[model samples]
Target: MIEKALQVFPKSYVYRNEELILEPRNNVYFRLVDVETEIDFKCKMFAWVSRPIAKSLNKYWAPRVLKSFNTLMDTNFTKSDMYLIYDRLGNDVNRKLTIRFIESGYDMELLKR
Candidate 1:
């Protein structure tokens, strides 16, 4: 139940035509992604690290966060809902949600790449 985030809007809105993904791990494969390949963080994807620090949620409490999100936002999102459709975490998404990594992706960069 590790957590990874996808941008809901265009990356660097100033560059509207450029799309970017924020990946911070070595092997990040969504359960329903169906593909078995290493993700490319080059192109337009920004390696999920900054001057401060950041990282994806570990395989421990991601589900709970999602649950809390569902409860707090009145949405019905499940683990299976991840990466299974465009509405969840992909391009042309149909929602207006923004990711707030809180402590997860905040200072973990000190311990990870």
Candidate 2:
């Protein structure tokens, strides 16, 4: 999964050290550490789990994940530029989640775009 994510975001720039951390709880957290300033910004992800499916599974197995990426800009980059990148990453994550669920033999209807 990490390798696939890296493939989605293959380029590295000089601004920051970004890493994606996924927990067993199905929570995806992104930490962006600024290289020069030594500051870290966090982005949390929320996944949509249907109530019926949640009850059936007896756990919070996220079917559709919605990522709201945010970071305070103290750097040279514009807010619009940051948001563009954030949205792209979010879209990539969404695609990955969909593919993973499909491969696991779960009904795709549990996930909605």
Candidate 3:
């Protein structure tokens, strides 16, 4: 299942470290920074798109999916200072989306599963 998900929506590694942190803001955005550089990358959530039928059929499902994504970030990340750009499209429909980095060298390739 994870392999198939990766094939559909590849996990883009924004940062790699022994301990990476992610913090979601009320504005629905996140900022990531290397603790050493003091420079940070800002990210914002765009849209939450799911399978058209599933989206239309269940109203609460989208939020649940998003919550799952948030949980994943919270559990996987080490610090809460970093912000995650929540792309529902990636989590829901398994579609890969672009994650713009405010700082350089932040974009990375996901580790092979």
Residue-level lDDT of model 3, residues 1-113, one tens digit each, is 12222232223222343222121221122223332322211122212222221233244443443444334322222111122322232232322333332232333223111
Per-residue error (Å), model 2, residue 27 = 19
TM-score of each: 0.27, 0.18, 0.22
Measured with C-alpha atoms, the lDDT of residue 76 in candidate 2 is 30
User: Which candidate number has the best TM-score?
Assistant: 1
Candidate 1 lDDT over 71-96, as tens digits, reads 43334545443323222224323212
Clashes of 2: 0
Better of 1 and 3 by TM-score: 1
Superposed on all Cα atoms, the candidates' RMSDs to the truth, in angstroms, are: 16.0, 15.5, 15.5
Per-residue lDDT of candidate 2, residues 59-78 (tens digit): 33322221112111112323
Candidate 2 colliding pairs: none
Candidate 1 regions exceeding 4 Å error are: 1-56, 85-113
Task: Give the range where candidate 1 is weakest over 10 consecutive residues by summed lDDT.
Answer: 43-52
**Whole-model lDDT per candidate:** 0.27, 0.30, 0.27
**Once superposed on the true structure, which residue ranges of model 3 sit more than 4 Å away at CA?**
1-57, 75-97, 102-113
Relative to the unseen true structure, what is the C-alpha lDDT of residue 13 in candidate 3, on a scale of 0 to 100? 26
